[model samples]
Target: MTVASITDLDVTDHYAEALHEVIEAKAEHRAPTPTTGEEKTAAPVVDLMAALEKSVADARERRGESSGGSEATVHEMPAKPKKKTAAKKATAKKTAAKKTTRRKTA
Candidate 1:
């Protein structure tokens, strides 16, 4: 099969022109109009985080209980959570401890 470039394809023909016009009309008809109101607010970041955490915990619990043999157990197991780099965890712990100290002082 030959790959034709834009220059190689003839767009001057009546069929091509008619097809282009039809496509333009269809696109204009289907185009979404801009809305003139406040956009809907998304759920809070903390709510999304909580949902993701709950899903991970549920998956872990499900994998722990299965009595089926190796293949079934392997299929049922969720993908492992991405391991946090030790440096990242240490930085997070330090920030959290600082916050706790601030709360105590306050």
Candidate 2:
């Protein structure tokens, strides 16, 4: 489609038109007209926590685990301290000797 001028553009806003009609009806002290077609209903509310628990129970049952049986426990171990290598030991000794043998400057 080609437009010769800015006025040729299709700028009809259905929402604005409907709002204007409602305002006019209110000014005349009459009820605003209801929109035609089937009315929409809100979806049923869900219990998320209960649904998740049931799902987990179903999965456990499928996996041959009893609902009231013992559950697996996890224990975390403390990480072992790293041992100093021979090169690191030598570097430490050198650093200590340098600090001890340094002369006081005036």
Candidate No. with top TM-score: 2
| Model 2 lDDT per residue over 1-106, tens place | 5567756887877788789989999999999897574579989999999999899899999999888856779889999999987664543445444445678899
Least accurate stretch of 10 residues (summed lDDT) in model 2?
90-99
User: Least accurate stretch of 10 residues (summed lDDT) in model 1?
Assistant: 66-75
Tell me how many residue pairs clash in candidate 2. 0
lDDT of 1: 0.62
Measured with C-alpha atoms, the lDDT of residue 33 in candidate 1 is 36
- Superposed model 1: Cα runs more than 4 Å off: 1-46, 65-106
Residue 3 Cα positional deviation in candidate 2, in Å, after optimal superposition: 22
Instruction: Report model 1's TM-score to 2 decimal places.
Output: 0.19
